[model samples]
Target: MRVLAFLDGTLADPDQAHLRVDDLSVLRGDGVFETILVTDGRPRELGPHLDRLARSAAMLDLPEPDRAAWERVVQLVIDNWSGGSEIALKLVYTRGVEGDPNATPTAFALGMEIDEKVKRARAEGIAAVTLERGIGTDLMERAPWLLLGAKSLSYAVNMAAVREAARRGASDVIFTATDGSVLEGPTSAVILVRGRTLYTPPPTIGILPGTTQGDVFRAAERAGWQTVVESFPASELTSADAVFLASSVRKVTRVHTLDGQPLADSTELHAELAKVYDSQYD
Candidate 1:
């Protein structure tokens, strides 16, 4: 099932939902967006997603999102999603039509059923290869114009990296900085497990702040595990007790292999973490 709603909290037929060809989101990729995982009709970690959306908009010099209006649209989508037990809910805000002096921002909410492939990856884990991000970790501070930490609509580089991973016979990718620091996945946050501690790179390193990673850390802390936010070298990934890629729709996915090198089997540990992770949705 699919659901669509506009910023005004009015439902729209999915087939009729449209955007102008001149919309800046199409013309210049000038927009911000968030993908949230909805379970049992409830959008998970919604507040954080909205918070990040506002941050992205501000970073792009766009108007601040009206939170209450967006929330209403989300609820409207959820009310219309009657068949799916899980939904990949996306919120998008774009600078409106180009060259139109009176154009206002365009915003909408869409919810669709989660793909079976995503479910399989979450359950069976995935193999990934590391790719260099071609920039140093300090570039974000050096060039703020890059919008490094914002979840903007310009994702060509990210998509290209994913394609590169596929060409290399891998299902996903982990991006590393020129300084050899582990960064993040093309569409997810990278998490490394060592003994009883969980580690993830800090958002200061030019990666989007991950909502699912935050939830995973909270789940770990509640389960008596230590969690650290710091930068670690890419070399550490292969040596870690376990590695995971966390995202909203995929949730927590273990890395079975990195660059075709088999990672240590941590099924028991993964189960423990997965249980804790799912409990957050409860």
Candidate 2:
């Protein structure tokens, strides 16, 4: 529960008192955000996360973020964190109050302790269910207003999807396109392994480009594995030697079951992939 926040230029406690009702993030969910993983007081894959945040902000037509300010704030939160080997650093900036387009954006950097659930999932694999996202891969290109590729504050739909997965006795949700193509997880990226080939859905398919996945791919390439970015069907998860949901915070958690069907043996492959992941940060 340890937490700190940098609100605008002010460093303060991240309690309810620091939040404003009129903030666009609270009122209309008009904002962009990034969740970074800090291990041993070091924030991993920070450059890519910042790049993605800026890209998402551009997509939303929001003001560009102040990188130096954000870096200072990130340091502030990290310095204030008292416990935990891992931390979740969340950066948020909204378009500001409605009708005041020129209003200064409401920005904050939050540092909080990582949840124990993440460690449990990494230790023991998780079960997932495939849910239709009701949109195709081409929709992002045609309907840019949908903001499908941007990581925005409007996550109620994703939260509901995860809740629905919980109701169905699953730990997470893998969203498939309307055409049954595996898109991604509600908050993570999907990766499948067959032999030495690692597959992840193409970012062109309207999925957020995963910084963790990118790091894994780079590590995999260095380990003499082939990495492919392509649109894959949900059935691919069933046929793969291993399946994982990857994100900055979650890292790589093997998926033990998909739609109640057990996946292939993931223990060996999970260890190998994890070795590659660990080697990168070390």
Tell me model 2's lDDT, rounded to 2 decimals: 0.88
In order, the Cα lDDT scores of the candidates are 0.92, 0.88
Give the Å error, residue 217, model 2.
0.5
Q: State, as a TM-score between 0 and 1, how close model 1 is to the true structure.
A: 0.98
TM-score of 2: 0.97
Error of 1 at 25 (Å): 0.8
Q: Tell me the tens digit of each residue's lDDT in model 1 across 178-252.
A: 999999998999999999999999999999999999989998999899999999999999899999999999999
- Show where candidate 2 strays beyond 4 Å: 7-9
